[model samples]
Target: MEGHKLGRAPNFTGACIVMFGVNLGWILLLLFAVYGLVAAIFLGLVVNHWVSWLEHRKQLADQRYGDVSGDT
Candidate 1:
């Protein structure tokens, strides 16, 4: 009955080194919060496939320059 007596200030080997440093800092902050949520869902699917490839290259340059209506 002599396990470094536990009756005063946290003494069972300092409460097992503060419960193994708080369970290794909560398992390294839960693996860096699941790698920052899988890098924010692959950076929002690469910025929504680069804004849908720049709106399909501005509708193929307004069908090769013929749209702003000045009667072609």
Candidate 2:
């Protein structure tokens, strides 16, 4: 009976390792997805800010020099 139980140890260890690996993979994938979404949102905000600043600068220029296109 002792020998039979010892023989099963390796199989149990292998199953445990496989389960751990699968769980780790899912956890890592979830973290990466969340981080990527946050990054995308941050990038969008930065772009919006730059666009707003540029528009403000254009307005200032137009005010100082008048419309160069003479469109009125």
Candidate 3:
């Protein structure tokens, strides 16, 4: 412990900066991945709505009553 200079090893400042950069990159990458996932979910919902509307319209075209069911 006498001559070790063991507080943060060697090149502490440079190593810290490098670690910070790596962590920042990882954070940005993770945020992008999450954004892509959310976007995908929203796109799926939009596609589902579009398909439902298209099918309803098709049914209306097939019959004059506009795709009505017996329940309501």
Candidate 4:
């Protein structure tokens, strides 16, 4: 019997490169998403604390001035 040459192996380098790029893109996107979420949470907390502080100041002012009707 004569030896025969088999078909060349499939070239997967291009596919691998594309998959790598896609994976990197997804990883970066997820990182930014998490950062945005954390930033939003911190911003909300800061805003809430500021508003509460202002309200507390107003209450103290009212108590000091005896303005219970909230007109002042």
Best candidate per TM-score, number?
2
Give the TM-score of each candidate.
Answer: 0.26, 0.48, 0.40, 0.46
Give the Cα-based TM-score of candidate 4 against the true structure. 0.46
- Would you give me the overall lDDT of model 2? 0.72
Give, for candidate 1, the lowest lDDT window spanning 10 residues. 23-32
RMSD to native, candidate 4: 26.9
Error of 4 at 60 (Å): 0.3
List where candidate 1 sits over 4 angstroms from the true fold.
1-37, 48-52, 69-72
lDDT of 3 by residue, 1-72 (tens): 778675754647788879976975675567568786676566556766987999888777768865455433
Candidate 2 per-residue lDDT over residues 12-70, each given as its tens digit: 76788699769756755675687876665665567669879998998899999988966
Q: Write the per-residue lDDT of candidate 1 for residues 1-72, one digit (tens) a residue.
A: 767777766448778869976975675567557777566566556766987999798778889985775444
After superposition, candidate 3 runs with Cα above 4 Å error: 1-34, 65-72
Error of 4 at 10 (Å): 77
Distance from true position, residue 35, model 2, in Å? 4.9
lDDT for residue 49 in candidate 2, whole number 0-100: 95
User: What's the TM for model 2?
Assistant: 0.48
Cα error, candidate 1, residue 18 (Å): 48
lDDT of 3 at 24: 56
